[model samples]
Target chain A: MWFDILPSFWEGAKITIQLTLFSAVIAFFLAFLAGFGRLSKIKAVRFLAATYVEIFRGTSLFVQLFWIYFALPLFGIMLPKMLAGVLALSLNAGAYGSEIVRSTIISVPKGQTEAAIALNMTPWQRTWLVILPQALVMMLPAFGNLIIEMLKGTALVSLVTLADLTFVATVLNSSIMRPTEIFSVLLVIYFVISLPFTRGIRWIEHRLSAGRY
Target chain B: MSVPLKVIYNEESTKSIGNDLRKVAVQPIVNYSNISKSYGDLQVLRNIDLDIAPGEKVALIGPSGSGKTTLARLLMTLEEPTSGTIEVDGEMLWHQKTNGKLVKANEKHLHKVRGNIGMVFQHFNLFPHMTILRNVMEAPRNVLGLSKEEAMERAVTMLKQVGLANKIDAYPAQLSGGQKQRVAIARALVMRPKVMIFDEPTSALDPELVGEVLEVIKAIAAEGEMAMLLITHEMDFARDVADRILFFDQGRIIEQGSPKRIFNNPESERLQTFLSRFNRH
Candidate 1:
């Protein structure tokens, strides 16, 4: 049973990993664009970004997943299940990730902006060279937590008929008729995947923060 | 050895330039023409008109909230004036003439005109992520468009002037209050600004640490050709370094003259009382 379960679990975990990685790339990109937009001096840009954050954060992730997976096909636009899963996860996580990015950037001292301006740096140059580097250091810890949340969110793709870890586990449970053994293995696999990622993020956080003090 | 010789050479040339500058009826390097600033109903500077001569060191001594710092910030373009114009080297700082009329200078115009000025804040405000050398090097490389090697050399020389060349690799957090202020001074000087403004540069430091920062400022003043505006509470230091002193009270200059006249024989009762209060410290 262990040998038979191993191959299925590996295949399931690989799909899970792929969905998580793809969604993560989208989430990270949207996070910065939306985060910086929230801080934009232009009123329209700020309003749009704020609206994006509020809408995604106010609604439920389950409904959001369903909308991308099921509701979009109502308009005659059908996305493949995996891409839909990635889009749902990415959009949901990105909303939360933007807030993390916003708060970390705001936490940087006002004096840093003043110093950059005093040096006659253009606004873009100031953001890129001075404020962003310092803000990035502060953002790393929160970003680690966001990544873990994103990994957990990948579990929901199973409901969308994706052959992710939980979906595979469900199939295994029904076939084997041993819920205890199958679910236990599923739980262990999630932890096993998360543990190395957690360690890697901590190491990066340590290295980035070391030079400041 | 070469650095010290170069410093001496710069000093001699600056002195000759200073003399030649005085012989000609030179325009004021910084002309504050009826500048006024207010935040809501709270006015910070009220119709302030003054001129800073080329190579002149002007010290502004005032009680807190009297607008000395605001005046310095306005010149740095950190704060915009409510009305009136601040001209740096005869170019309008906050306004640009468009077609035939004056319009508020756009960000592009302001950045270009603002190149000739530098300022030091009470809080050292060094970029914490950068090492001391990079803090000094940043503006020159980014704003002045210096190459990396040229910027590095200038930053090293500026740091040496402030006596912090050895600490170039150290970050701001690793430095003391005095050392951070020194780095801030070096950071500003590397731009070779025509007008340098110091807003209570030593105020954030411990009493023992203030002397080192003040010493660096004095050395900077000795190198002529640039106008210096210092907003300071250190009366003795101000008197020693300033060629002229303006005694500020309630957003206005109550009296201004040579440091001797302002310090030894204050004409206005407001300034007399202000001096007595400072004397207690």
Candidate 2:
């Protein structure tokens, strides 16, 4: 019974990797834009970003899963459920990531902007050259921590019919009635994905804070 | 290179203002006419009509909350005036004259005008992400179109001038507050601004470290090219280095004159009291 799904675990692992990489990239870009929008001086931009964040962050991920997978067909815009799952997880997680990026940017000393202005740098130059670099360095450790959260978040995508690590475990458990074994293996898989991420965060945080290195 | 900044600072640019060699009448570099600024129903500056002559070293001194920083920000165009106009070299600063009517100048205009003015803040606003050399050279390379070699040369020389040559490769976090402020001063001076405004440049420094920065500023003041507008609480620095000192009180220039006239024979009781209790000694 366990052999029924052991042959497909590699396929599931591939999907998990693809989902993690794809969703991480999408979440990062969206989060950066959302963060910048949230901090924008223009009222319209700030409002739109704030509204998007609140909506994504406040709602349940399962509700988003159902809505994107099953509910959106009523609007005549049907997408494959796999795509829907990835989008749902990324967009939901992107909201929290946006806040992380925003806080990092805000934590950057205000003196940095004033210095750029006094040097006669255009606003765009200062953002790209001065502000973004510091913010990126600051955002890296938080992002490393987010990656583990994102790994767990991929589990939510399984509800929309994508055969990820959890889906494979569920299938094997049903076939063999060995729930304990399946669940324990799933725990190991999640641990394998998350442990390095935790260590990477510690390493990065240490490197950044260490002075004169 | 659209404007020959070198031409603006040539031998012909240095004409005496009557008998005073210390004062020059090159051109009306910055004219703030009836310029007033406020923040959320609080009027910070009232009907300011100040004309800074070319090569003038004006020190702005008053108690805290006297609108000195606001005025400095106004001249740097960091904040828009609530009313009236500012002109730099006969060109309207915030709004330009278009077809005989005043209209807002575009970003192009602001860039060109703001290019000519450099200011240093009291907090030494150095970019933390950059190395000290990069901080000094970024504007020169990006805005001034200086080649990497030329920018490096100018940056090194400016670093030497500010006595920060050894710490060029270090980040701001690695430097002392005094070192950071000197690097900031170097960053400003590298651009060769027509007007250099120092907003309490030494106010944040420890007493031991303040002298190095003040000495750098004093040397910059003596070089005789850039006009300096200084905001300082150092009474001796003001009395010794400032050519003219303007006393401000509650967002108004209550009195102004040479440093000796201000420190010795102050016309306003406000100035006398401000000087007596000032304990940064």
Candidate 3:
């Protein structure tokens, strides 16, 4: 009986993995862009980045998913279901991820910036070379938590009819009427999927912090 | 015999006078004109007109809160003066000439002007994440645009100068406070700056460690090619290394002269009192 249901769970797991990976890539880039944008000297750029963070973080991810998948088509912005899922997951996660970036950058010692300046590095060189490398290490733990949150958050895509793990589990259980057996498997799959990400971040944090202590 | 002797005297006096006049005519490498800085209601520096000649080793000595460090900071472009202008190597540091009129300097102007200056902080602010060699190599490779090989060669030479060649692979945290400060000196020196500012470079070190850092500084000053602005509480080091010393008190240069005159004569009462404190120590 377990072997019979395994292939169906694998199919849903693939979709879930794809959503997490795609959303994570977009979220990572958005995190740094919006992160640096918030620190920009230009008032307009700072304001725009702050607005992006506030709007995304202030609203629930569920509403954002519903709005993009259901409401956006009302205004004629017809996105595919997959695109909508990725978009909502990344945008929501990116908003939270950006605060991690900004605060970590700020926490880098003021002396580092001054030292770079005294070396005659331009503002850009100082930020990228001196500031960001140190900040990147400090940002990893928080980002690990965020990626796991995003992984779990991928379960929400089931509401839009995408056959991710949770959607497949629900459909399978309704027919078999074996909620305990099926849902237990679903919980294990989710936990299993998120484990590697946590380990990966820790490995990176260890690598980057080599000799820093 | 008397007529020939008089002719020799005139020629010798004329040559000496010419030499003195030429020395006076040489342009100062750093000039601060009517500069003042205020932090809102609190004034840090008053109207200060000062000039540092090329290759001149000038030490600034004062009680804490007398604005000695602020003077070097202004030159390093780390802090801005509220009013007045600074010139580094004959170009304005705080303002630039545009169409024959002075305008507040843009980033390019500031970068170009400040390229001639470098500073070492009290904390020895080495990049803790990078190895000692990379800490020394970073600026020359990135800012000066030297090739990696060239930067590496320069960094190695500077580290050797500061007696840290063995510690090239060590991270900053692995080094002692004195060793860290030496790496900082090498880092600043690798830039080949025209002016190097030491903002109490040895103040943060342990008492025994201070000698090592000071010895490195003394050797650098001995080379006599780069001008140095030393903000120090070590009066003995200042008297030994500085050609001229400026005594600052309450945001003004109360007295400045040859180290001998300032240390021995100490004309001002404040300077006398300041020297007395150091004497007891």
Candidate 4:
């Protein structure tokens, strides 16, 4: 019976993995864009970035997923279900991640920027070459936590009738009447999928922090 | 194998004449005119006028909060003066000329002018994440657009000059305070700026470590190719390295003269009293 359900679980796991990765890519770019925007010298840019961060972070991700999936169509802008799920997850996660980026960038000592300026570096060069390299090392652990949160957040997508792991498990449990065995298997699968992400972040953190430690 | 004596003599005479003409045409490498800065109501710098000639070594000595570091910071564009203009290599630093009028300089103007200046901070702000060689090579490679090979060559030579060639691969945290400061000096020196500003360069080091850092600075000053503005509390080091010294107190330069006159003559009561504190040791 375990072997029979394993194949179904793998199919569902694939969808969950895909959703996590797609959303993570979008979230990563948004994290940097909003992060740097919040610190931008232009007032309008700062305002826009702050608004995005606050709106997403201050509200519930569950409602955001619903709004994107169910509410966006009211304005005649219909996104496919997968894109909607990915969009909501990324936007929500990116908001929280931008704060991580902003705070870590801020925590990089002021002297680093001054030193870069003293070298006659342009603002872009200062940010990319000097500031970000240092900020990145500090940002990884927080970002690691965020990635895991995002991975877990993918379980929410099953509610939108997506055939992700949790949705498959629920369907299987109802049909087979084996809630105890199937749910335990479902729990193990999620934990197994999350392990590599945590390990990968640690490996990257170790590599980036090679000399400092 | 010898050249004609008369030919050598004529060449020397013409070279001397050229030197005289060049001196008249050359503007001060760094100039500050009527500069002042304030944080809210508390003013840190008052109306001040100063000039640093090419290859000149000027030391600023004063009490804490006397605004010596502020002078260097203003020149480096780290802090904007509340009023007045600075010029670097004959170009306006804080203001640019537009349509025969002086307008506050933009980022492009400041970047161009600032390329002529380099600063070493008291904290030796080497990028902690970079290896020593990368820290020194980064600006020249990215900012100056030097090729990797060229930047690497320059970085190696500079590290060697500072006696840290063996530690090129080391991170800043792995080095002593003095070693880190030496890497910082090499990082600045790699830029080959017309003016180098040292803001209490050795102040953050251990007592025994100070000598190594000062030795690197002394060697650089001895090259006599770059103008140096050193703000330091090391009285003896200032006296040794400075061609001229300015005594700053309460945001103003109370006295300025050769190191000998500034140290020995003791004209101002404030300067006299200031020197006495160091003299006590």
Candidate 5:
């Protein structure tokens, strides 16, 4: 049964990898801006970042995907279904990643900031030269985990008829008249996609924190 | 390649201000005219006017609520005055120099003016993520544009003075409280400001460590070439190093005079009782 389904699962995995990788890159870049915006002193900047994070995080990602893929067309806005699905994933994942980014930045010792200021570094210089590099190093593990979650989240896009891994799985199951075997194979494929990313982050965290402990 | 911790500071005197700057050589190094600060409704300081001659040692001695820390913070521009001006080396700082004259200083002006002064906090505010050598050399290489070799040489000499010359590469967490405070002094001093202000530098150290930090401070004062403002809880440290003591009470300078007079014969009854409680040998 496993051997029979391997070829079909392999086909499904290709689209899953593309959706996850494309969304992850977009989400990672947007999260940096959103996270730093939340830390901005200007009220408007801070409010905008907070509003974006809250609007995205408070709602379900699946609902968000549906709105982009299914609901936007009624408002006279037209977008490709595949494009809409990736946008929703990136936006939603960015909201969650921004919080992780913020907490990681704040966790750095305040003394480092004081030291930077004492050295007469401009605010921008301090952010990039002193703060952001350290913050990026700290964010990687959490971000890596988020990427894996986002990969799993791409399964919801199957409902939009994107022909992603989940959609292909459902089609194969119906055609072959075997729900349990097809579903189990689908689950294993998702696991195969996620587990290595999870382990990679763990290995990174261990290597970075190795001798510090 | 490094040594133990020593006296670190924000003012790296050796760079621009140097050890032998005369008050009148260029102009006044420090002038705080009618500076005031308030946190919400609680006014920490009001109507403070002060001037420090070059290389003079002024110690601020007061009870806990007497605005000692606030004064130090104000001078460092860590907290700006609600109303008034702060000038450094006779240039219009903490305020804009308008029409070839002085106007009320704002944040931008303070940024430039404050670049010339350095401060050391009581809690040692050392960068925990950085090693002691990096902490010592940061401002010099970054702000002062010192070559790595130059900053390292200064860092070593400063550490040697503070007696922590052996722990130069150690992290703050690895050092004792006294060691951390000394590294903080080196970090501040690396900038070579005209004046150095230490706010309760020894208060947080273990008793044994306090004396070591004080010894470094006393050596700084005795050098008699760098204007220093010290805020300390140690009566002996204050008396030993301070040329003059500004005894503050209730947000006011109750009295200011030579340490011998203030510590021995006080003009105010408030000072007498306050000093008496801790006046033990």
Candidate 6:
């Protein structure tokens, strides 16, 4: 049964890998935009960014995915399963990631901003040249955990019938009637796949955190 | 026996004398007109009208919370005044003439005016992620639009002047308090600002480290061309470096005169009590 299921699982794994990678990239970009927006001096920009974070974070990723996949067609805007899954994960993960970006940026000392200002730097230049670099160092530890959570969040894509790893594992269980072996194998596979990501994040965190307390 | 006196009219000395004459001809470099600052009805500074001449070294000394630091911050534009205007090098800092009408200065105008002033903070405030050389070079290259080579050369010279030339590649965390303050001075000097403000530059240092930072400041004062405003508690150091001392009390300049006069013949009871406390410490 394991042998028979290997090819199907491999196909599902490929989609899952692509989905997680694309969603994480998109989510990372969104997090920065939203995070900076929240800190923007302009009230409207701050409010809009805050709204995005709250709307996504206040609700369930499961419901969000289901809405885009199942309900949005009623409005004559049908999205492909993969697109819906990726969109849901990106928005959800980006919301949480924005807080990580914001808090880290805020935690950088007020003295840094004052020093930059005294140097006659414009607000944009100060943020770019001084504040962001230091904040990025502080964000790495929190960002590592967020990335791992994003990876785990990709598992939900299976529910929308995207034939992700979990979807394949479920199919195999129903067909083979070997629930114990198939489910255990599925669990082992997820842990195996997620191990390198966790290790990679730790490596990155270590590298970025040099000379930073 | 008598020692022969040789008269040497070196070009550098002549040029320095010419510069001094030029500085004297210009009006005050910084002028504060009826400046008042208040936070939620608690007045920090009150109707402070002052003029700092070119090449002048004015030290602000008073007891804590008497608004000495607030005055320095106002000059640096770190804190805005609730009323009145400030001018640096004859240009209004928070106000600008537009269409022959005075209007509140915008960001662009502030940046232009701010280029003429530099501030050395008590905490040093060096960019922790940058190397010492980068911290010194950043404003020159970015704000002043100097070429990388030019900025680096200026940074090296200023660092050498501060006696931290060897630590250019070092991080701020790797430096002692004295060394960090030196780097900050170098950073400000690289901008070649016409007005320099030192906001208790020695207050944050370890007692042993204060002398080294003050020595660098004294050297800068000795070669005075820029106007300097120092808010400091180091009374003796102030006497040594300052030509003029303003004694502040409860947000007002109670007595201001030559450092000798202020130190010796303090008029106000508040300043007298403050100086006595300072002497006891």
Each prediction's DockQ against the real complex: 0.64, 0.60, 0.74, 0.66, 0.40, 0.63
RMSD of each: 5.8, 4.2, 6.0, 6.3, 6.8, 7.0
Candidate 3 colliding pairs: none
Residues B92-173, model 5: lDDT tens digits: 5666757966677655666677787777776777765568888888777776779999999998888887877899878787
> By DockQ, is 4 or 6 better?
4
Docking class of 3: medium
lDDT score at residue A146, model 2, on the 0-100 scale: 78
| Candidate No. with top DockQ | 3
**Share of reference contacts found in each model:** 0.70, 0.62, 0.74, 0.85, 0.32, 0.70
For B114-153, candidate 6 gives per-residue lDDT tens digits of 9888999989899999999999999999998999999999
Reference-based TM-score of each model: 0.93, 0.91, 0.93, 0.92, 0.87, 0.93
TM-score of chain B of 1: 0.91
Error of 1 at B264 (Å): 1.0
User: Considering summed lDDT, which 10 consecutive residues are worst modelled in model 5 chain B?
Assistant: B1-10
How many Å off is the CA of A46 in candidate 4?
0.9
Error of 2 at B204 (Å): 0.8
lDDT of 3 by residue, A84-157 (tens): 99999999999999999999999999999999999989999998889998898888888888989998999999
Model 4 Cα displacement at A169 (Å)? 1.2
For model 5, residues A1-213, the per-residue Cα lDDT tens digits are: 666877877666888898899999999988988998999989999999999999999999999988887788899987887788889999999999999899989987775676576666667766776677678778889999899889989999889888888999888878987888888888888888898898999898997776331
Cα lDDT listed for each candidate: 0.86, 0.82, 0.88, 0.88, 0.79, 0.86
Classified by CAPRI criteria, candidate 5 counts as acceptable
lDDT of 5: 0.79
Candidate 5 error regions (>4 Å): A74-77, A107-110, A200-213, B1-27, B98-108
Question: How far in Å is the alpha carbon of A121 misplaced in model 3?
Answer: 0.8
Name the runs in model 4 displaced over 4 angstroms. Answer: A1-4, A202-210, B1-26
Task: Candidate 2: list runs displaced more than 4 Å.
Answer: A1-8, A41-43, B1-26, B278-281
Angstrom error at residue A138, model 5: 4.4
